[model samples]
Target: KMFACEHEGVTPDILVLGKGMTGGYLPLSATITTEEIYGAFLGEYEEFKTFYHGHSYAGNPIACAAARGSLEAFRNNDTLEALKEKVAYFEEELKEFEGLPHVGNVRSKGLMAGIELVVDKESKDPYAPETAVGWKVAEHAMEDEVLLRPLGNVVVLMPPLGIPMDDLKKLVRVTYESIRRATEGKPHNGNP
Candidate 1:
């Protein structure tokens, strides 16, 4: 919906979609466009206006079957509605970690979130890149059996959408503990 709204004017000549399109099971992508674009290539056989592009396995029947089943599951089970409720609960729980000593901000939408960490809250000074604070937090989380990835000093969370509320709570808890462990006793103001 957001993409449609943002690209309203530019009637897409080609639409390419991949990653999470089929729930990330089998790596597949698609290109879709109006018949008008396809008709543009309707010319003499000698004419070289035909655009040709192909993947090694462009139309694997099994992948198509999986995509079809996934779509049906989405409609029949209202997976999106359930996801909305879960994301709402998750975001509300994430808010509890705000205002922590090293946590600069918590921003989230749907099932994704980024927790930015800073050395100082007043000036919003990020930890030195050499310190690799985000990496440390991610490593600590892994030690606690919570896998996480960091983008720069921002800890990103993209947990599975269907995680139960209890597991979600544990995820948040482990994330908080990991951050605390990483930054604890470290000088926030670059002083001893």
Candidate 2:
């Protein structure tokens, strides 16, 4: 299904998009289709067959305005180009912690990243769930004035798209410190 839907010359009958569509400032999504699809329901008044799906905020003017402004800013600032460079730098800097004593893996795409912690690097075994290693690391990061959230045993970083290089460095440093503090004096047979 995935391959067929994504392959060349194969167009989906309906396209549903969500998440980051409005840069996550508001809750909104869209179901887009071609004019042909819409024409199928265009008929006489008595024969009208309109779909019935609604949200209280559907067609919200404020959200539409925000989306337009965000798109404009993206184009005016060449945000995609800038992100291409920034993401490359981010990935390189993030990888530096790969062999840290408690760090298991670093995975990143664009400006989003996840740092996994492990109790045994060779075995790639995660710390006990009850240990709350990820949660503790996030708390320590907050203490350092950097916010992070944990997904299971992985610490996820979703920094803003246009974060400055200096700030990015600070983020990496803070993450390292957070991990160290969270696991300080604890025995782990990981990266060492």
Candidate 3:
């Protein structure tokens, strides 16, 4: 919201938000749209044009309460402001992985990052699905006590918003080590 509304000076007509809304507790989401968009749905009920879209568990009070709590937590901690140093450190630390042979790309925004591993670094050919490249790196990371979740062939690093500096560095180092182990010419299914 801040990035779009302030940084880019853009206002979206409609915004659909979920996942973090309920603090990952109950499955609930909300759609917020401009008055102009809402006006489009302002037809007579007799015309049966009332916008209708919802889930069974929509507007659950418990979930809403959790979401409120999450918001409060953010406000109390000023989480974004506090995470600046940590985010920068995480980014700088990620630079080391670029030297690795199979590291195709290392992209990041704040705390969310992805390290793309490639079979052919020059051609940027991604590993086969059977190779499970991303998962392999995550598996190796887990061995070093760094929990990782990969998005397909990109090993995604989404640490907690306010993770400690030490932990964030560990995450970077563990991720680099993991990618190295996965792509250092080790045979998977005897496909050397």
Candidate 4:
């Protein structure tokens, strides 16, 4: 969303925010409508024109209170501005993997990043789906204490907003080492 707003210059008419809005402290999501769209839903109550959507815990008092506190923390801490700096450093730190074999593309947008693995760099040939190459890297990364989520051959990194630089660097190092070990001919445990 930040990438779309800042880099792509796009503004959404309606936005859906979820768990991350409360920093995962509660399960909640909100569908925010633009003024124009919201106005469309507005009419005389007698007209029977209304949008009714609710969940089991839709307006739970505890959850709503926590979410408000979370939003205020973000505003007070200047989280967004601080995130830009961390994202820049995180992207730069991962440059260590650019020269590694099978390291195809390093992509980052705001605090999210993905390292795409490939069989042939020039041709950008991805590994076989059944090979589970990304999973291997993620499994190996856990050995180095950095958890990653992989989509096919793309290993994704999305650290928390408050993670320190040293920790982020550690994540980068672990990720690089994991990919390096995963792609090498010699196996880490000598199994294959």
- The best candidate by lDDT is 4
Task: Give per-candidate clash totals.
Answer: 0, 0, 0, 0
Whichever of 2 and 3 has more lDDT, that candidate is 3
Q: What are the RMSDs of all candidates, in order? A: 5.6, 5.5, 4.6, 3.4
On residues 45-84, what C-alpha lDDT tens digit does candidate 1 reach at each position? Answer: 7998787877986788887777777667667877677786
lDDT of 4 by residue, 64-91 (tens): 8888998888789888788877888887
| Candidate 1, residue 13: lDDT | 73
Global lDDT scores for all candidate models: 0.77, 0.76, 0.79, 0.81
Worst 10 residues of 2 by lDDT: 183-192
Q: Candidates 1 and 4: which is better by TM-score?
A: 4
Which runs of model 1 end up more than 4 angstroms from their true locations?
Answer: 1-15, 34-51, 185-192
lDDT by residue for model 3 over 1-192, one digit each (tens)? 223354467788987888766556678788989999998889888987788998898888988899898778877888878878887788888888788889899988778788888888799998889999888887877777778988888988887775777788778877777788888944333111
Native-referenced Cα lDDT, model 4: 0.81
At residue 149, what lDDT does model 2 achieve?
Answer: 87
The better candidate by TM-score, 2 or 4, is 4
lDDT tens string, model 2, 1-192?
112245366787777764455666877777877888877877877885676666887778877777777667767888777877777888888878786777888887677789999987788889999999999988777776788889978999888776877788788888877787787753323321
Displacement of the residue 162 alpha carbon in candidate 1, Å:
2.4
Over 4 Å off in model 3, which ranges?
A: 1-9, 185-192
